[model samples]
Every structure is written in C-alpha cells, then in structure tokens.
Target: MTPRTTKPQMSVKDFEELARRAPEFVRLEFINGKVQVKPVPDGNHGEIVMWLIRRCMQQRPELSLYPEQGLKVEAYRKGRARPDGCLAPEENFVGQGEWAEPGGVLMTVEVTSRDADTDQRDRVEKPDGYAASGIPVYLLIDRDACSVTVHAEPEGGSYRSITTRPFGAVVELPDPVGITLETQKLKDYAD
Candidate 1:
C-alpha cells in the first residue's frame, strides 16, 4: 500500500483573516489555494521601491501610487499579490472615496530578492497575471543577475519579449509613456 500524505490548503477568507490578524508582521497572499507570505522588504527592496515610487510621483503627482498593497483585481477573487511598485494612470486611479477601484495601473514593478525561484515566478507567472489583468508594463529588477527585464506587448494571454536592459543601463519606455529605470542603484544590494 502507498503511504498517504496530506497538507492543508487555505481558503481566501482564511488568508484574509490571517493578514488582518498579522498586520504588524508579514503580508500574506492566497495563490492557487496556497498561502504565500511575502518576505519583509530588506534594505535593498525598500530602497528600490521607494526610488520607483518617488520617480513616478515626481513625474505625475496627480496620479496615485499603490505600492505593495493588496489589490482585488476582480470580483469574488481576492489575492494579496502586491507588486513591488505600481502606478495608476490618472483616469482609473482609486480616488479619495470609500471603496477602492481596481486601479487600471500603467506599470507594475517587481524587485527580485535572494530567492531564485521567486525571481522565476516574477519573470514568468506574475507577469502573465499582470498582463491578463491589463497592465501595460511589468518591469523586473533582478538583483541576482544584475539585470532589468521589461515585459510588454501583452499578446494572447502573455507579454511578448519587448526589451531587456542590463544593470547600469537605461532603457527608453515605449510610446505613450516616457519612463526610465536607474539600474545603478541596484548595484548596492545586488546579489
């Protein structure tokens, strides 16, 4: 006879309760019926996020910036998936109202950590999710290899390989937008 093995799979409500209860600690997400806890932002992660947020804010102070916040992109679906940084275009920006709108964000940035697998997820799965949700640009800052990968041109359910820039290099943003990333800052905490 084969040995039986089992593990608990948490529901979205359970995860939400956990997040609320552990608000002071780590933020949790329910992905594929699994509870994924995001690592506390180390110094590098925090600096990068802050830099991106400042840049976006300076460019368009009128637009709202949602950084690493729980975003409910669709009804009946609640995922604690927080992008390292996200910029909501003026139109769909969550206004100073009661409930939050699913901000039709123009860009979502994910800064990779020491974990190699998470980097892969950010490169592959998360971009797919962002593209599926109509995000125009997904910038990935990979500290592990010192490179910046900008995923765009969402076609069919995924983004086509638009362009890739190395560390200390600057890549021009596509049309309708003009943004630039400073990879030099990454050298500080680069793995």
Candidate 2:
C-alpha cells in the first residue's frame, strides 16, 4: 500500500482564496491552470532585484519597480501571477487589492530563481501570460545563463519580438519601456 497525495487543479477564485489564507512564508502563483509555489528569494536574487530597482529609478524616475506584485493574467484574466517585479507609473496600484488588473503596466520583470520550474515558469509560461495580458514588455534576468532576455511587442498571446543579450552587454528594452540596461553588474550576482 502507498500513501497518496492529490493535487487538484484550481480555478482563479479558489486559488485566490487559498493564497489569501496561505502563510507569509509561502508564495503562490497560478499559471496555465496549475498551482505554482514560488520559492523565497536567496541573497543573490535579492541583490539582483535591488540592482534593477536602482537602474529603473535612475532612468525612469516617474516609474516604480514593485516587487512581488500579484496580477490577474492570461487570456480573459483567468490566471493569477506574481512577478518578481512589476514596472509601472508611481502610485498606480493605490486603490487596487490583491490581484490587480494588468492595465498601465509598462513591464514585468522576472529574475530567474534557482528552482526546478524556473525555465517553465519564468521563461515559457510567464511571458505567454504577460503577453496575453497585453503588457508591453517582459524582462527576464537569467542568472544561470549569464544573460538577459527582453520580450516585447505582445500580440496574439505572445511577444512578436524577443531579444537576448549576454551579461555585460548594452541591452535596449525597446519602446513602451525605453530603458537601456548596462548589465555588466549582473555578472557579479550570477552565483
């Protein structure tokens, strides 16, 4: 005899209810109709987010890089996700609750975590989700690959243009998010 554990596929409303009651130590996301457990940030991950925050503030002072923002995503806004950072005009989320609508979001930033699902969650599913939500840009800081990939020009549930630049290069984030990043500093946090 084997002990069994069952995982039920959750709807958006159910997922939100569970997430609300979940302890602070746990972070949850729903993508592609599956419940995802987002791991806590390690020191390196925190450092990278901090680095990006500084850069975002310097280039676009009117915007803010909000960390761990829960957003309603996917087609029909049926999916829920929490990007590592969400870039939008300052005070954009003042009146919103837990899962905010994706409008007015200039970009969604994800720093790859050292987890089994990083590739699927960060690279594949998330870009699709953001693209489907019509967010203009998706920035992925790939620590393992020592690179940064920018996904822009969302259309038809995907980005029309995708560009990847290795760490230490001058990367342009494209229009709607015209910030140019000097990612040489990212090389330092690639642990």
Candidate 3:
C-alpha cells in the first residue's frame, strides 16, 4: 500500500512514540514530515527479497541483507525509514537502538509495493531522503515499472548519479557496493 498521510503532522518524537506502540503487524515510517504506514509484503515481495538474499550472499559473503531495518534518515537524523533491505557488514547494527544511525550502511533497498503513491514515495521522496542521510546507495526494485534503479553519489542532499535498468538487464550497484546483479531472474518475480 502507498503510505497515506495522517492529518496534522506530528513531530518526530511523537511519531517515534506512536510507532513504538504500533502493533507488530503494522510497519511505520517517518518521511518528509509525515507518518507513513508501510505496506505488508506479499508473496511476490517475499520471493524478490529471497532472491536478493541469495545473490548478495553469493557475491559478498562478508555482508548481510537485513530486512526491515529501521534507519535514521534525512537531515539531522530526523526521518526514520525501514528499508526493505539494508546491506552492511555482518553485525553492523549489533548494539544499536530501535532507530539506528545510517553511518555504516553501505546500501538500502526498497521493492516497490502495489500502491498508488509508490512513484511519489519510492521514486522521488525516498532517494532524496536517503541521499540527504548520506547512505551510499539507494536501490529501488520497481515492480510496477519492471525495472531497477541505482541511486548513488549523494552530494548536497541528492544523488549525483541515477541509473535505471529493465528487469532483464544487468544492473551494477557501483562502488562501495560493487555488486553486479543479473536481473534476468527478477523477471520471474515481477508484478
């Protein structure tokens, strides 16, 4: 589901409190000064994540793909996003609290959900937020577009480079990540 904006924007503190009290089944995020309820993953989403897990493990065994990792994003660690996958060295967040700083995160991934505002949230706002937070890369698996986008080289609150490839193409997640994905397999899980 595309995140629906709640009425009367709340402070990050209040949002964090509410998110803590939220039910286990619901996922929450704070972005662009609005509270967003994340969509539940469907079977396709699960398969895609699993596929990524296998690929990442095969290529970079030193790192682990952490699912739904709560990250402090945007300026001044004001925004919180639970990326679909956070790629970092093993045990990168061992002692962190609920919302961990994005200091050592190599990359953050998001697989698009079947929702109305995905383009706005994922394609536009998310990259800006992640870039501002200085996360090295933001990988967006756009199910609706049947494509994958790699956002890298964050400078002045935006990514200097943006590359998008079709599902069947070879996608390279540039330096720091240095993983080339054979996205042909992703075609099988396309929504």
Candidate 4:
C-alpha cells in the first residue's frame, strides 16, 4: 500500500510546540499549515555530506559548518528548517540554538534521495523558501543522476543563478565564498 501523504493540518504555533517536544521520528517544516517529514538520507547521501564538509573545512577553515541541523526562522510562526549541511562565515553563529535565520546563512546544501517528491521539494519548494528568506546560496547534490545545481542571487521570490554540474565536472561559487566544488568526488558515491 502507498503510504498516505496527507498530513494533519496544524497552526504554525501548534506545530512549533509539537516539534520542539517530540522525542522520536524526524519532524519537518510546516508550510501554510501542511507538514512534511524529510527522509532520512541513505548512506551515500551521508558520505557525500561528510566529504563536502571535509573539503570545505580544508579550503575554508574559518567558516562554521553544520550538518543535518535545524534552524528557527519565520519568527512569528515559529517555523524552522533543517538543511543537510550548511556553512556560516565565522565562529559566533555556530551554536546550539536555531541556525536558519535568513542572511546569517552563507550556504545551504541538500543531497537528493530516492524520493521524487523529496527531490522536487528540495529543488523547487526549498529554493523558494530559502530565497524568500534571503539565503544567498543553495547547493543541491543529485548522486542518483550525478549532478549538482547551484542557486544564487535571489530576485523577487526565486534565485537568479541556476547552474548544473554533471559527473566529473567542476563548479565554482562566486566571490566572498570562493570555494570550488569537485563534481567528480560525487561519482564515487555510487561505489
């Protein structure tokens, strides 16, 4: 049987209290009263996140990094978001509290899993959410397809720059955060 997709309706406040209090199972972001439970990424996704973190640490040791972490945004609604991994420019922002506040985020990454709906959520809905909140960079890693998509320069309600890197390709983020990504390492995820 197909798992039912409809989530119980919730007010933003109620959702916040419930998520903060829940003990087991992964919780997720609620948009317009709808709930979404993010998938627990497979081993390949975990490896890729670790590999990317390692590379970023080597190239930009000054930045604080977060993996599978959640952040509180939408202050009134008390909504939150947890990206697969993220980078913060300096030490002050790296702490135990929420980390998804707008411009405070230098970059956010999402490693696609086996679910098509989840992929669409990351590729479409997430960019909208991130861009609307002013996150400057969003990186998407698609190991199943061996590709990377970078979304930058938010305009209106969406990101202006969209670049895809296929397997064995190299892609570079713009200045300030001039980190070059090696797409080839992504292919090793398949092994």
TM-scores of the models, in the order given: 0.78, 0.95, 0.94, 0.84
Candidate 2 lDDT, 40-105, residue by residue in tens: 999999999999999999999999999998999988888899999999999889899989999989
lDDT of each: 0.64, 0.91, 0.89, 0.71
Segments of candidate 1 deviating more than 4 angstroms: 1-8, 73-78, 90-101, 175-177
| lDDT score for residue 115 of model 1 | 59
Off by over 4 Å in 4: 1-8, 73-79, 92-96
Which pairs clash inside model 2? none
Could you tell which candidate, 1 or 2, scores higher by TM-score?
A: 2
Which portions of model 3 miss their true places by more than 4 Å?
1-8
Q: Which pairs clash inside model 3?
A: none
Candidate 1 lDDT: 0.64
Write candidate 4's Cα lDDT for 1-191 as tens digits.
12222443866667777767766566576642456677777798899889888888888898866886675533232446778877777754555555345456788888887776675577776776666666788888876767888889976657888898797888897655678987787888954
Ranking by lDDT: 2, 3, 4, 1
Residue pairs with colliding backbones in model 4 are 71-100
Scored by lDDT, the top model is 2
Rate residue 179 of model 3 by lDDT. Answer: 93
Better of 1 and 3 by lDDT: 3
Candidate 4, RMSD to the unseen true structure = 4.7
Tell me the lDDT of candidate 4. 0.71
The 10-residue segment of model 1 with minimum total lDDT is 1-10
